[model samples]
Target chain A: MRRFSWFNATSLTLGFAFLYMPMVILIIYSFNESKLVTVWAGFSTKWYGELLQNEAFLSAAWVTAKVAVASSTIATVLGTMAAYVLVRAGRFRGRTLFSGMIYAPLVMPEVITGLSLLLLFIGIGLDRGVMTIILAHTTFSMCYVSVVVSSRLVSFDRSLEEAALDLGCSPFEAFRLVTLPIIAPAVISGWLLAFTLSLDDLVIASFTSGPSATTLPIKIFSAVRLGVSPEINALSTIMIGIVTVGVITASLISKRASLRLQAEEQAAART
Target chain B: MRRLLLISVPYLWLLALFLVPFFIVLKISLSDTALAIPPYTPTLDLGAGWAGLKGFFAELDLENFWFLTTDDLYWKAYLSSVWIALFSTLLTLIVGYPIAYGMAQAREEWRPTLMMLVILPFWTSFLIRVYSWMGILSQEGVLNQFLMWSGVISDPLMILNTNTAVYIGIVYTYLPFMILPIYAALEKLDISLIEAAEDLGCSRFQAFWLVTVPLSKNGIIAGCFLVFIPALGEFVIPSLLGGSQTLMIGKVLWEEFFNNRDWPVASAVAVILLLILIIPIILFQRNEQKQREAEG
Candidate 1:
């Protein structure tokens, strides 16, 4: 048996505390009744109420949602296609370049990507609005989605796809009926990643957006540039809550799925 | 035809959106700044045929690049960005290594939950995570309050809007990137190797340094590159946490474009920044390729 030392225990406790303490403090301070952010007067939900009533925050939230949904959906399709080509398609012309393009944006500084995309928009006479933001978000986030999906595709069982082909299915039909169902989890996760990336983006959106559009990050950024505010804290807490719930639920579902699969395999072996 | 269509659709989309924009930035970097709507001189006038193309080529010069060399601010910003990225990457590794080792040493059944705990912060909004530090780092913030209350210090430390805050933010935000890779490496480590080393007359500390650290070198390399590359051009962290004294190239580029409206200068700055990043990025790619090959 491997021994767990006191050193290990202490490190783990301190590490997690360091990681979580800032956000924990922020969450606690969100309900402070005092106008001063640091001082504890009493607990109240007034900041949350104020956050809801702010028209600017509401519109920015709506804009962010629209961009996230539109961009992530489009990114998922393109990214999935890119992943399929990368994993399944044998060597083709410009394969190196194709792969490079897919991977470059994954690590490319957001400032450069945002600047280049903005220049492209200007050069092509495209207006900077929600549409431009969508385009920019889809372009970058697709790279992330492809990375997620392609990793899954790399480990996929090929015989399942080959069997569909043997059963007289066209390539498209085989993919749609067999491969899609199998890779649906990866694709969904890819979509979620793309969604969150678009939602969290500030620099790219800031570069691409005009007077006609503003994302939540941009709004929050401008607000916090001065200093911390309770309303912003409330907003941060809400975002943190949603993400925590989403991540926990997804992990639980996947865990249960694997457990059930393990049970089925054991039963099959027993018989 | 079907295969062709599938390849071409994404290929064309990337060509039009990703590849072309990069070329546009490159071209603009060579051109002079203009007061026009597009904000750069000598834009390609394809309608005028050969003469227009010739004229465009003739008009383009390396002035923007030259300007970058003459200006000390750009040079300082680039140098400072590298310094900050390197320093923060080291800090992240220090903070992350122990956590990764601890997680790897954890009970098998508890490992997955621990992994999820580390990843949960990653799934949350990065901006919010960074912004959360503001309330704590501010003069009247919780850290100061705690310190004063405990008689640890009589005065609040000046952390906000300083380079120290920027370092703290970078280390805080990029900690997971460091931890996850190292944990993956340490988890895959064979316990028997350490036991054998002990049997061979090495102490536990000696075994860790000689056997464990060398084995996990790939993870350490990957994690450092992951932190260093993004942190080099990090915008949000420095902009929010750093004061006027902070001089990262990313923030410089943002200011040049937005506050100064010098798109040509911004493009020039970006071009140079990409050049500096190319070496590290290539090395990172090679490392990833090697790891993938080993795994396969």
Candidate 2:
């Protein structure tokens, strides 16, 4: 057993404290009764109420949600297909370029991606709107989705897919029935990742979005640039709450699933 | 046919969106600025055939590239961005290594929860994370208030909207990128190797230096690249936290495009930025390739 030294304990504690302190402060300040974000007053939910009432913020939220759903869904399908091809397709022409495109965007700067995509839209005479934002989000987030799905695909048992094929199932049917179900968890996680990425993106969205559409990040960015406000604190708290719940729930579900699988395997061994 | 269909769908999507847009940026960078809607001249006219091609080729020049060279702002921004990225990447590594080592040495069952704690903030809004610092780092904000109360300082520190704040934001945000890869590497390390080193008359520090550090070199390389590459082109942290004096190329590119509305110049900036990035990017890719090969 590795001994846990005081040094390790201190480092871990300080590290986590550093990681979360700003967020904790922001969350606490969200309910400040005073308009000043930094000043303390008696706790109140006025900012939340005002946030709910702000039509612009609400509409921006609506647009963001719409974009997230549309983009992530399409990204998931396309990314899954990309992952399938990368793992299953053997020595096709331009294989190196195919994989290069897959990995390059993961590390590519958002400013570059956004700039290039905007120029493409303008050059092609495409109207910049919610549709353009969706296309841009789909293009980048699909790379993330493919990354997530492909890691799982790499470890997938090929024989199960082969067995389905041998049982008179067509290739498409085999994939739809056997491979899809088995990789559903990865695909779902990929979708979630894509969704969060789209939601969190401000730079790309700022470049691609027209006057017709604005995302929540863009709204928050413009507001925050004028300095911190109590309303933004409230919004941040709400966003943090949603993400905390989502991530915790996801980890819990995956944990429970693995535990159940372990128990089932142990029981089968006894039998 | 089925196999071909599966490959081509994604292959073509990436070609049209990713590859073609990149080429367009390259093309625009070589063109002259215009007052028209798209803001660049010599748009390809296939209708004019070979003559049009000749005209387009004639119009294209390295004028914008020359313009970038003449301006001190462009080169200075590039240099400062590289310097800032290098500095912050070092800072992230310093802060992250101990945390990652601590996690690797932690109790087995606590590892997952610890990992999740690190990732939870990542899943949250990045803008919010950067924005959250404003309330703490401002002149009259929490840090100053606390420091004053603790008698650590007599006056409020001017941190927000400064290069210092940009450093803080970059280190805070990219710390996770550094920690994860290092943690993965440290976790896979054989403790017995360190034990053997200690048993063979090496001191604890020497054992760590000889065994642990060398073993985790690949992780260190991966983590450094992960932090460095993104930090080099980071837009958000600098734009929000950095003052007007802060000169990051990403911010420069953004202002040139949106604020100045100079598409050709902006494209040239981006092209240069991409050129600067290509070296590190290729190194990162090669590192990833080597890691994969080692694992396989």
Give one digit per residue, the lDDT tens place, for model 2 in B145-167: 99999999998999998999999
Off by over 4 Å in 1: A259-271
lDDT of 1 by residue, A1-271 (tens): 2558999999999999999999999999999999799999999999999999999999999999999999999999999999999998899999999998999998899999999999999888998999999999999988888889999899888998899999999988999998886677789889989999999999999999999999999999999999999999999999999989988887777667767767886997899
Q: State the lDDT of candidate 2 residue by residue for A1-271, as single tens digits.
A: 2658999999999999999999999999999999987789999999999999999999999999999999999999999999998898878889999999998888888999999999999988999989999999999988989998999999998998999999999998999998997688889899999999999999999999999999999999999998989999999999999999998898788778768867886997899
DockQ-derived CAPRI band for the predicted complex in model 2: high
TM-score of 1: 0.98
Could you tell me the C-alpha RMSD of candidate 2 in Å?
Answer: 1.4
**How far out, in Å, is residue A155 in model 1?**
1.0
> Per-candidate interface C-alpha RMSD?
1.1, 1.0
Residue runs of model 2 more than 4 Å from their true location after superposition: A260-271
Every model's TM-score: 0.98, 0.98
